[model samples]
Target: MTVNRFLIPAFAAALLGAFGLIAAAQAQTGPLRIEITEGVIEPLPFAVPDFVDEGGAGEYARNVARVIASDLSGTGLFREIPREAHISRVTSFDSSIAFEDWKAINAQAVITGAVTVSGDRIVVKFRLFDVFSGQQLGEGLQFAGTTQSWRRMAHKVADAAYSRITGEGGYFDTRVVFVSESGPKNNRLKRLAVMDYDGANVQYLTDSSSIVLAPRFSPTGDRILYTSYESGFPRITLMDVGSLRTQALAEQPGTMTFAPRFSPDGSRVVFSLERGGNSDLYMLDIGSGGLQQLTNAPSIETAPSFSPDGSQIVFESDRSGTQQLYIMPAGGGEGRRISGGQGRYGTPVWSPRGDMIAFTKQHQGRFHIGVMRTDGSEERLLTASFLDEGPTWAPNGRVIMFTRETSGAGGQAALYSVDISGRNLRQIPTEGAASDPAWSPLLP
Candidate 1:
């Protein structure tokens, strides 16, 4: 996200001098644009040459380039041309462009970079180009970090490229928190765990001694809220992700608290509390330690999610004798039903963009992960299986990560992600079965 606007003019001037007429024509024209609408789909072809090594950087340079290519290609929007098919090579960061070479290979975009390693520190500088236009899409940028953080640097590069081209934010530099499960289906052991957005650098936050469920990241990404059964009853607990310190919240005698989610401003939390065998939604001020009941319905109400602007909340309830979705003011008021369909809806999560809300729907003996607008129109099921629930939105709101469980004697749950357009459904690699994934915002 760190872009150098000043360098763009200089880079464009350099390209104009190097490619002459092609660059002039490109300047007269513009960068290639792709219209992402409901229609026929075609992935844009792009190339990333192996990064040149400087100051004896060696293998790190090539590996970083490979990771960048993989990240972009995995999005299903960009196709990477193989290195063997690359007609031109990038030998230096400041080298002149060979627009004809890339144009001949039918590449619409090209990424070139150089890597420098000094002891434990590594620096990667890259530039993106419009191959056909013969113009630099953006200014050259560099990222400096430790060698151990090379993957993060590569993700940063991919995110920058994706944003500049698609005119949208990227989710590459984020994390996911979920419950990792082990043992048999009948005697499952679950613990809270977290990892990079790509499922790398996993770190367990809690031991498996107690069952954990519905792990959620705070808006700031520095804390986590989840339901734990350590005391033999589900209770909401908030933990400092860095210190691994936890403190139980909404503790009451003979009461169970669960399904906790942070407010948009991280000043309060909304969750479900079961007392006298009835579950209802309640809001708790994190700093004041005060609680307020938001719903007084006789039916069960839970899975409340606050809108991005913190003015409203979307949640699930069975007030009509069937599970359905409802929206209400954040401060508590009459709820308006938003879901009207054949199936039962639950686990409604408001999208970051404030345009759509994702949910889990059950119909015809099948579970699906789907999304619809705030007014309950344009419902589209992204995936259908024996069980696909607990949809969590990416930071950019372009993708959803959810839990998919198989149906059988050995049924298990795992994490999966799909774009909002219902394409690129893929399973995220985890060390063990995982569920209830919550994605964090882009890292600082």
Candidate 2:
């Protein structure tokens, strides 16, 4: 099912007020600032008290507070001080701040909030403070939604805190679409599934009767494009996420299409089409049902992705007798070879920031997830394993999630994520084996 962006009322006003407060406070006390570019060797210590229940929010208040703390701590840039070490409690949202008490516990930052539940609705308001300077980091903001959406509200609060302190966008408010697998490794059953960025709120989009691969979300997260073998051959299918309806795009009797991705505007798709035992890159206009061939060569050209501005396209080809990366105009022209490494590269994906491209490289019997500049300079391998491929970027372009498969008789595939800086590598929790992860853009 389709997941709509969370509606946080008065967010702009809150953000403005927050930044204004931070600026005023900075002028007065000049608190310590985090320079993200320099890299964080030590995580900043912070604290979060159980949010006050304004009007009987029940257990939701505590749970929400815990989730916020978890989100911040999971980033590897913040450390959560246990509540037991607290010298002062946040009994109310408007209570006087105890900067001294927090400082005694060596807490650099603190978060305080109140949760109110009325009928099925829930509202959460929170503020961030620099304990050392005794100043508010930003203006307090409130988020309101249904009780069932409490987790999302907590994530928003964490995102705001992350952005305000680090001066960067947050990726917590996004979703990932992937192929969930089960059964034996020899005969794995794969189907399309979607989940929260943290691997929560999982929902299946297709049954296992038909094998699915490379499930990609539209730019707006309202639709999905995937390759299915329902017709006994791989064919690209467009799906309305909310309705679970599917339609074939550019369907041809003798050709197969796969590895489809939506354009930045969500009005077109780029994919690989196979005909006569040869595969090439093609683009399709969704509105006009028009098709355009982007690449024509004897070598295979596939896994095409568009830059953030939609001006250029990146793909993989073996024109030089080895799979390598190439960049060309969005409309397709004489492509310039970009990758000159000592290996085969495939699945080149442009970052959301449009600064670098993440790809899968195979060399010396090992597979790695790596990134290179748009011109194929400063290449760095972020992960190496028995098998790691399909690197998809986080909403903020600071991290990548990909599929990792084990090597053995009982080997299986699972989803994994790694920071772009080559830190915080971890596996995403899933019910079973999973692969071909596709992360959607941040919710509205």
Candidate 3:
């Protein structure tokens, strides 16, 4: 995730000029009246029939079906009618569904799938239907792989059905790479952990011997870049997922660097370096191993993020007496501040849409997760709580993921996501204590 900041005076003038010409040309047209419609609406109810198994061989054949049901329910958009309420059972993919039975239970949609075992491979065929319209919504899908891959298959089927109906990409088929923490706060155990977006199939990529922070997924979802304290000091490292091999990035003496993010093209990494009692942003050329300093500020500057176009950089700095967001050229140059509100801001991250920036704002002793335009206009607060920091953007820019810690002893930190509309708040399960969650782009 990246944050964007643009100077107000120059940006506002350009917006007004562009709208003025369009308003004048439409003034000469005939008069028209616009009406606003209001009505009460309801969410559509759906039913997921129990997935049938032709041969009982793998545990995934039974477990994967329940996982898909939980994933859809967590979205808060779909209502899955229970199996006890199901009026008909689907035994084969070639059979027709009894649309009337589903309608009796007030189900607007229905999903059915069949699992079979062919030698060492697990085969699945699934279909989605609109009970109200009494028609198949889309083409059926077939997936074949080892039994361990059944969970991924279930997510892919759910993603396909969701995308076909809403015309938006599905996040269920993706994974999240976050830092898993354990032990006391002062001497904590941290490692890079990856799990399904729904919190299943958790795997630890690194051991707990070394401390890790800010694990970010590559744009291709095949690699990860993070800051590790493996060498008794903070250093940046990149890990290859397929080969499980990691190598140190660049070397800097007596300087601590953290908050690493990959470029939009995944060719370079930009991070923060603390040297001579000052912190600044820097970029490392992945191919040539060249070091380029990006900021020359005297204050603490960290949390560097790149714009979607890979032309500008947004970061947090305290050079203005308080922490605020600043924008500069990606190749290092003089920066301009864009946050002038009545508080301090940190963790400035840019949205994937290239329009707004998401960050954590502290005002009057309360923490807030908010979004502002590129020019610092239209600041909207999405969530406020005891301690909410580290905002990561959803792939579509409609949702934001962050971590919240409770107050007092025995308190724990957990991952959560909230939409920009201030609705659909959900708590994502973690194996243990978790923080600094980084959401991956849609899987290929």
Return the top candidate by TM-score: 1
Error of 3 at 190 (Å): 1.3
Q: In order, how many clashes per candidate?
A: 0, 1, 4
- Model 2 stretches astray by more than 4 angstroms: 1-32, 38-40
Task: Summarize candidate 2's per-residue lDDT along 1-444 as a digit string, tens digits.
Answer: 111121133334443332111111122244633334332356778899999999969999899999999888877777899999999988989988999999899888899999999999999999988888788887889999999888888988988887776655788878899999999977889999999888988999999998899988999999999999999989999999999999988898999999999999999999999999899999999999999999999899999999999999999999899999999999998889899889999999999988889999999999999998899987889899999999999887877999999999899999999877777788999999999999988787
Candidates' lDDT values, in order? Answer: 0.87, 0.86, 0.77
Where is model 1 more than 4 Å wrong at Cα? 1-30
Residues 248-351, candidate 1, lDDT per residue (tens digit)?
Answer: 99898999999999999998999999999899999999999999999998899999999999999999999999999999999988899999888999999999
Native-to-model Cα distance after best TM-score fit, residue 332 in candidate 3, in Å: 3.1
- Cα lDDT, model 1, residue 216: 92
Candidate 3 Cα errors over 4 Å, as ranges: 1-42, 56-62
Error of 1 at 355 (Å): 0.4
Backbone clashes (count) for model 2: 1
lDDT of each residue in 305-404, candidate 3, tens digit only: 8999999998999998899998888998887787778888889889897888899999988888888877787787878888889998878666688988
Sorting all predicted structures by lDDT, with the top scorer first, yields 1, 2, 3
TM-score of each: 0.93, 0.92, 0.86
